[model samples]
Target: MGFGHANAGYRRLFESDGLTFGAGFPLTGANRSSPDVDAEIRLAKHAESVGFDALWARDVPTYWPRFGDAGQTFDTWPWLTHVAANTDDVALGTSSVVLPLRHPIHVAKSAATVDRLSEGRLVLGVASGDRDPEYSAFGVDPDSRDEAFRHRFEAIRACWREEYPERESEWGSLEGDLDVVPKPTTETLPLLPTGNARQSREWIADNGDGWLFYHLPESTLESYIADWRELAGAKPFVIAVRVAFADDPTAEPEHLHLGYRAGVEWFREYFARLEGYGLDHVIVGLEDDDAERALSTFADDIVGEF
Candidate 1:
């Protein structure tokens, strides 16, 4: 299979008529937390078994106490590969890999390796670096991140799609002599530019396979999707949302950071509304003490509706 219709990860998320769902990694609830690696793998497998469409790993190079979120607390590539080994079909995703601080060649090789190993079940969510301190640590100027992000994005695409690509970039030049080995399971990986990635809407439409945005109110989302449809046609629109299930099935929705607090019934209605508004996929963040029960309930209650 090639890049578009046949890419396993992209197909799973973007196919059909309604929204698909994914679970973000380090499914822990507390701040700056990293649970046992074995438990994480088990939960990942459980998420897949219960019918989540994807599993996302975040890129947090260093743990900053001020940020208060450890973001999976593992490097993306190996963690993804390890998850791939255990779970069969769930798409392995990076919640958004910061491109400015890292070299594209390494990104290219590592991402392609995961895709090849996972049989095309990798989808990349690329982003401009978020933290100012990370930029200082990496010796990359925050202002230059705009250009650096674009260059790195292009370079990674080249490495995946071409044999010995002759490319010049701020980081390094490919002289067309050495190839980045183990090309993707498809012609190239699917790139979802995460939260603009310091790019214009036109650039995202021209380049990204999809757009991964943060959560917003439904009215606001309708406006965003309208703009996206105008600029990007039917390209997928994805978001990360936090959800909490109340003990009462009919409990009404209350506002939470980036999402809502409610019972499964209200969530069912909420997600159905999202699908109606042309939203393509949702990355689910659950804060539950009983992980297995939470995933099982979500799969049966919320996911089954869509």
Candidate 2:
């Protein structure tokens, strides 16, 4: 099988039609209270039961005072473990784990552990990280984040591949003395790098197994996917969109933090455009304050509509 279709867990997500739904916000912020662990687990299971394609978790290590969005209100690793145990057969993943915040060994171990526990249902998303305050809080130079990310990426691959790989990195060194445990079920975890992250477009295409881009206009996405395909050599690509649904299909759409205001009709039309644009999969996030209403409407109106 080729890279796009090789992994069963990865392929399942793309093959689905219509709005592939996922929820955002496991975290707490000044504006929003965090969902408790049990609440999130139950919600994840509900999404699975409702036939959502995957479960996505976000990481916001340090909520910069200025950065209003505090995603997934908990430690990413432990939360992922909990979600993995609660849901069966749903692909569990991170929207993008800020790679420069933590050690590569930790990342590899956590990713492997989750993938193992989930029976190979984990997809790891990585980003160079955009929060300067979080970097500063961790005592890392934000200006050097790109370099740190590169070294960490290399280290993560090594941790997965060579047992006790000998290497020296600014992040740290693993002198052939020990290896990370709970090796990933696959030879290498499917890594979807989000945004440019200091890497050139050509490099992102060549290195990443897939691309995770923000919601984009249809024409723009067409051009971007064309560019990616030309350089990516047929790797799958994913897009994330924030959505809001109303029981009344004609209800005036509300503005979303990361997405535009649109009703189900508009969403269906947008998704059709995406399918025509050669997109492999789309992760839909409901940004509405009422989680129950958002999930219910999405499941009843969007999921089945598609």
Candidate 3:
């Protein structure tokens, strides 16, 4: 089924003509060390209170010091469960879970558990492993990632949708002898492939319920969305952006990693343009040290405007 028609988490965060906003986890600016869990949960609750549509968690299983970001410093499952219990109504998502590095059975089980606990509010963003060290560390063949990713994705879907579904792949075979219990609240959970996941655009459009991508310039985004629509139709498109909100509304934009430093006015215009470009959601990673103030300002000034 098309993502728009599916009674899944994607429906909670997307619509055809406008944009919804989500707040990224680790909700603080502490990058070198572990994030303060208390502060993050507090801000997560505050984000929901202030009308953010969702909360996103990243799956960074093994922290490689060379990569430089700790990524919420918690495993995706428990972290999402904690956030799920603490908040009401806001959608919960993994910025992405690395599919190739972990077994699909474990991912399926953990994801369904969270989906059931969250009452069908889980939008799973999945990806092929990107951190090079993780492949060897996990004893997975890096060269086989593309095939592994495809097989795992299929396994996850079968686990969610069919009882003891028989399937065969390089990963393994399910012989219809046993079932993965606690299927999603719906027949299928929403899966948004992150940044191609080593697949072609057509493959992503055909398979993923939605698409989660990195930041791109406005012209590039416009063209990309146009191409996406031709193949995937109304399937949602989501992007993650880093932002540092300046105090003045009129402050001009400056470049930052994967996003920008801008004022409320610029952001308001920028997001509206994104909405016009057929974007569905934007997950904002606040770059400021004072996450509370930044979130409050963005919600009140930018999100409120949208």
TM-score to true structure, per model:
0.96, 0.90, 0.96
By TM-score, highest first, what's the ranking? Answer: 1, 3, 2
Q: Record all residue pairs in model 2 with backbone atoms less than 3 Å apart, i.e. clashing.
A: 26-72, 26-73, 27-72, 27-73
Off by over 4 Å in 1: 1-6
Worst 10 residues of 2 by lDDT: 24-33
lDDT of 2 by residue, 1-306 (tens): 145323445755654433355555451112234667666676677777776778888878766557776777677778888877777788877889989898999999998888888888888779988877788788888888888888898889888877878878898888999888878887778888898878888878877888888887668889999998899856777888777665566666566666756777767666777777778777777756666556666777667665
Q: Write the per-residue lDDT of candidate 1 for residues 1-306, one digit (tens) a residue.
A: 123534899888887777899999886554386768888888898999989999998888988888778798878999899999998999889989999988999999999899989999999999996877999999888999999999999999999889999999789899999999889888888988999788998999889888999999899989999999999888899999999889998999989888888989999999999999999999999978987788999999988887
Show model 2 residue runs off by greater than 4 Å.
Answer: 1-8, 15-21, 27-32, 251-255
Candidate 3 least-lDDT 10 residues:
1-10
TM-score of 1: 0.96
Structure candidate 3, residue pairs in collision: none
lDDT of each: 0.88, 0.75, 0.88
